[model samples]
Target: MSFIRKRRSLVLTSTLALSILFLSLIAVMVGLLYKEQKNAAFHGFTEIGAKLSAQAQVSSNLIASVAGAYENKQNPQAELVSSLQLQLNAMIDDDNLTNAYYMSTKQFEIDGQPNLITMIQSSLSSEGSNDNGTDYPLDDVFLDGYHRVMTGETLLTHAYSDDIGTWISYLAPIKDDQGNIVAMFGLDYDYDQVKRELSALLWGVIGIGMLAAAVAIGILFFIIRATVRPLGMLAVAAQEAAQGNLTISMPVTSSDEIGRAAASFNDMIHSLRQLTSSIKQTSDEVTVSSLNLKEFANQSSQATQEITIAIQTVASSAEAQFSSSQETQRAMTEMAIGIQRITESSAIVSDLALHTSERASEGEQALRDTVHQMNSIQTGVLHATDTMQELQLASGKVDDILTLITEVAGQTNLLALNASIEAARAGEHGKGFAVVAQEIRKLAERSRESSDEIRTILQAIKEKTAAASAVLEGSAEEARTGTELVQTTGSSIQSILASIKQVSDLVQDVSAACQQMSAGSEQIAATMVEQEQIAKRSSTNSHHVAAASEEQLASVEEVSGASEQLRVMASKLGEAVSRFVI
Candidate 1:
């Protein structure tokens, strides 16, 4: 990379490192702070737990005092056990308590199976009583303070789980009037709430720590940029120097590392400027010396009349060479023009192809639209077919209804005829009844013919609709095929347009190269004419100054040979330069 690019990249990397380091420091500090806060919170929670345990002891003592007032001969309800249970339940009702239960000691007889009577109040519904005829294990809270309860000291034991592990209970003793252990009371509190609060607090602290880290990173970026600003300025100045603008310089006011770099840049530019000036003067002198040598060589050649006479053929040969060069130049010019024409034609062809592609695209779009419309038409046709099927069913229903009406009409007519016959048996009223029956019979016959004609018309409609649906399906399929063809044509046309665009681009490049060649050949022709004039002038000078043609003639031959060698070298150099196409 260039110096400026490399320097900028280094500065950016340094800034990133500093920012990351600062963020890491912030993380460490925040972590320590959070750890201390978490410890303090846990210590406070432990103290609260101790206080709650102590309070449970006080409530248990009060319950035991109340229970001791009853006589042993009384029933369980009459002995005030219920009241003590109620009081214990009220204490457990506190938000911090989980469960409270009462267990009677005298309720079991065996040593392994300690007598236990479990009592619960309504508020202590989550506490359940298990079989009291079971041995108390070493880990049991009730076993730890068995002596304390026996002594009636109002014992408080640490919290622990029972056999089923439903709740963590703090068990305290209940006593009777004789200062003997009667029962143990307990209060269970949930632990999940405490954990949840701690987790929320941890997340809050982490969120604040992340926010602080982000702020610190932003500040670090600014600080790093301030530190590297002077270096950036020196870097741009150095770039200008490298591009040959040696007068470029950077200001140096500070005594920091960046300031020192700027000072060195100024010193480097000064030295380069001096060196470039010396080199330019030396090159100019060498160019003048080479031209002088060429003139002297022409002069030496002209000193020999024979050589001059032989080279008079050069003017003629040069004319022929010039003519050949002009012809070659003309051919190149024509080729360049032809290539330009071809490029233009290709561009036009590409444009026409693009137009065709666009038209094909439009056709494809139209086909797509037609396909969509055909799909909609097909949907409508299917709906129509459904409607026609429904109509045909309705038509059948109508025919059945007509047949029923005709049957009912016939039945009424038959009933009327029977009534008329009965009337004719009565003789006088029979004539009017007979006429009515005859009219109903004629009307039934006409209705039957009309229903048959309606059925025929419905059958014709069904056939015509079926034929129309088949034609619609065939048309829809043809539309889909046409859409695919149009899309394929559009794709093929687009590919052709792309190929033509590439050809046009290559033709343009060829034309540009040919134009450059024509320009260079014109410059060479002009330079050759200038050299021919200089040769004739040197020949005239040589004729005027010659004191001895023999010595000058020898010099002329030597110079001519040198000039020929120089021309050969120039030709080789031209060939070497021509190897590059552009």
Candidate 2:
């Protein structure tokens, strides 16, 4: 295949491959990001649930402790219940609990008054059949626990939902001196808070993930266009040069991979130009040699025809010479001189062919050297392409790591949220824990942001690496085709050399025969002038043959010089291409 076509193929294939790789990286990053978001969401939900559960437990414990304090009769009725209720209400008000309440099964009065207890009873009755006349479910668990308190049974049921919210209701039975329950107390937590926090966190993470993805895609697109496009241009240029179109120039004008590739392409073009020029020069010389050979052959054919006519004349003379033998001998001697001249011309042709063969051998050696250098360049390009591929793979791995980091950040955020909820529920006692929760959440946010940055950077690296790989692959393929062309030229030179060698051997044999012919032609007086003329013609042909040989030698030298220059240029191109490492 022609170098140009191979180079174009390489360019197209490399471009497509790079594009695919870049897209794949983006897809992998996006997938990883999505997974991280999902993990974060789940983790956030779990943490939120656990925090809520912890807060609820702590609240429940506080309610039980306060209830125990109230039952101990540490002070008077109004003072203890009123102060205790106020404090318990304050606790619930300050935290995330659904409700906190304490009620007595006995006649508990406000402000140290008896009739007030009756009024309170009447109020409770008016509100509901359970807690006065209220429609809301009002259970006097203290009344139910009256007998259980003596049995030391404090009922704590599983969490449930009420008008207030989902809650874990704790029942701590308070007993009198008579071992009868007097009051019951508990608090209800706002269980929905966990779900609310989880929802909020989920949305936050999703928003960040979308933003990151958008940024990454944008960056990748920019990088691919900026970097890959130039590389493609360089590849095209290289292809053109390889095809013997040395005027091709790369459009990429940057200091990056594209720029380097373009420069290398230019260098390769220069080399190819020199190589082609040499080959053309050699071919021109060969053409001139062929013309010389054709002229020599025509001359020899004419001389042979003249000799044949002269022989006919001599034979006729010989038949007529029964009357005069001298005339027959004279004609015969002239014909022999003509034959000697023809033999000498043939000898000159043989010498020219020998010189041509030697020149061809030299050309063949130069072509072989050029092919070897091109092969080395091809090998270097292949290695460079492999290195670029490895870089792209490494970039992919970095993207994966970013995804993992993002996921962990999300989980950490969830944990912080849960801790926050727990601290809220803990009220004044949980204040220190709330600060820790806040810090953790901040750290998570930072981590998420960092992962996003990493993903963006990795995406850029992936794009650049992919582009580099594409350019390298294209260059390698072009070099391979170039090597093949060089090899082909080398083979052609060898063939020409072999043909020349045969011609040279024929010429040497003809030279020996011509000497014998000249010696045999010496005795005929009438043929003497003809013999000298043939020798002169032979000498002129030999001079022309020598001139052609000199031209062939000069052409061969030009080819060798061009081939050497090509080798140097290819080496320079390979060196320039190597600059993109890393």
Candidate 3:
């Protein structure tokens, strides 16, 4: 087994198996034909023996008389003997079925079997070939048959070798008028001649059988080639499909099983093609949505950053205004103290006090006017501050929207990633889909990056705004102190001190209002930072709106399915993220 090569094919196997079977059938046929022919030759010998015995029986009287005449030294009828010889001569010819014939008288038994001596042989006839008469012992080679024939039974012998050649002999007994078996007639057929005939017949049969086997084997190969070649092609096509090449299709050439199978394969390829198309389309949609969401989030972030920067600028300006107001309040406090002492002196001197009172009255009116003017400035600053606070709050709201956009982008990215995984599982055929998924993922990442940059800028603005707000708080505290001093001065120096004090109060109020506005702006800016961060995050995964968007965002689940529920994206990042965030 180890020494032999083990290569096998359908054609080889089929041809080998059938060849063995056909050869075996032919062998059986030849064996049977040969056996039958041999049997037929032996049967012919028996028939000839019987015929000779019949003739002998019909001339029993002549045979008996001839034997009696030879025994008594008298001549039996020559014409009768000659006529019998002539009849026997005809059967002895080379072309005749029987090779030789003889009459033999049974004498004695050896080993319980009768032996014989040939009495009248057919060799003296013109066509005769054998001359062993009276001396040739017939029973040696034909023991079984001769013994049986002497007992009044006809018998045939298998082929045996004699002095002349191999022969099959048949022996029949001849009976006298008294029914006593006197002699036996023997007929012989040449075994060699029969064998030659059988050989010729066998050769003819073999020639035809071999030719038929050759034709059959050729046909077997042709059938296998026709059938198996198509099947092999189908196999190759199937392999391509297995490798994820759904583009391959088999051609149906017939209505046979192979053809039907090919048709089915083509159908399968078509279905797979459609399925891949759907998946690819879904991925493409997700990519577009993410990109759009990213862009929207980025814009919102940038706007928020700008607003935060503007608020920071306003806070810095307010800080400067508050500083100046505090300086003015300090000057007013010093002057107001001076006016109080002066008012004390005026009370002591009458005429001086009268003039002083006149000046004081004018000063009182001027102080009142100054104070009112300062109040108006304070009111204006307060409104400005309030407006700044509202703007910050609005910015925070805008940040919230940005956050939403970021989330949409991030989700779209995730969906694209999932689609890529599925494509990988599908193998080489899914290479195109995988590429789409990669593009989508890249787009999402870009969205996330943009959102991050904007969020950073917003954070920086928030920090600056907070710092400005701190400075404003210090300024506001100083303003409150200066305002208290202004009130005290107004009570003491009713005219002069009052006017200075009122002016100081007005300045202080404006400073305080500006400080409040600055603080509010800072808080608003901080809130905007938080909102922007949220928005950026939202934008980051917002692309894959399928799962999280729709339910989390709404219909982020379906993107649509293969749609099979393509939710992996339907918030599919919310209708391709509002079709470019228009």
Worst 10 residues of 2 by lDDT: 115-124
TM-score of 2: 0.50
Model 1, span 417-520: residue lDDT tens? 44544444445657677677667657765665565446435434443344334333433443344334334433433443344344334334433433443343
Instruction: Give a tens-digit lDDT track for model 2, residues 18-86.
Output: 556555655665666556654554443334333433333333444344445434543334444344444
TM-score of each: 0.33, 0.50, 0.48
Rank order (by lDDT, best first): 3, 2, 1
lDDT per model vs. reference: 0.46, 0.48, 0.50
Model 1 bad stretches (over 4 Å): 1-200, 203-207, 304-582
**Model 3 worst lDDT window (10 residues):** 552-561
lDDT of 3 by residue, 1-582 (tens): 211122126546756766676677678867886897677556545655665567657767666665555445465577765655555554453532454444555355556656455545565432445343344444466877766776778887777886767777777776788997765666677778888888997898778767766776666656544544554565455444444455667778897444554565565455445533433443454344334433332333333344333333324454432342333234323323332332232222223223334544543444344344334434544454555556566657766766777778767876785576556547788899989998998998798667745653453344333323332333333333333433443443343333323323332332333233233334433433433345443222222221211221111111111122222332332332122111
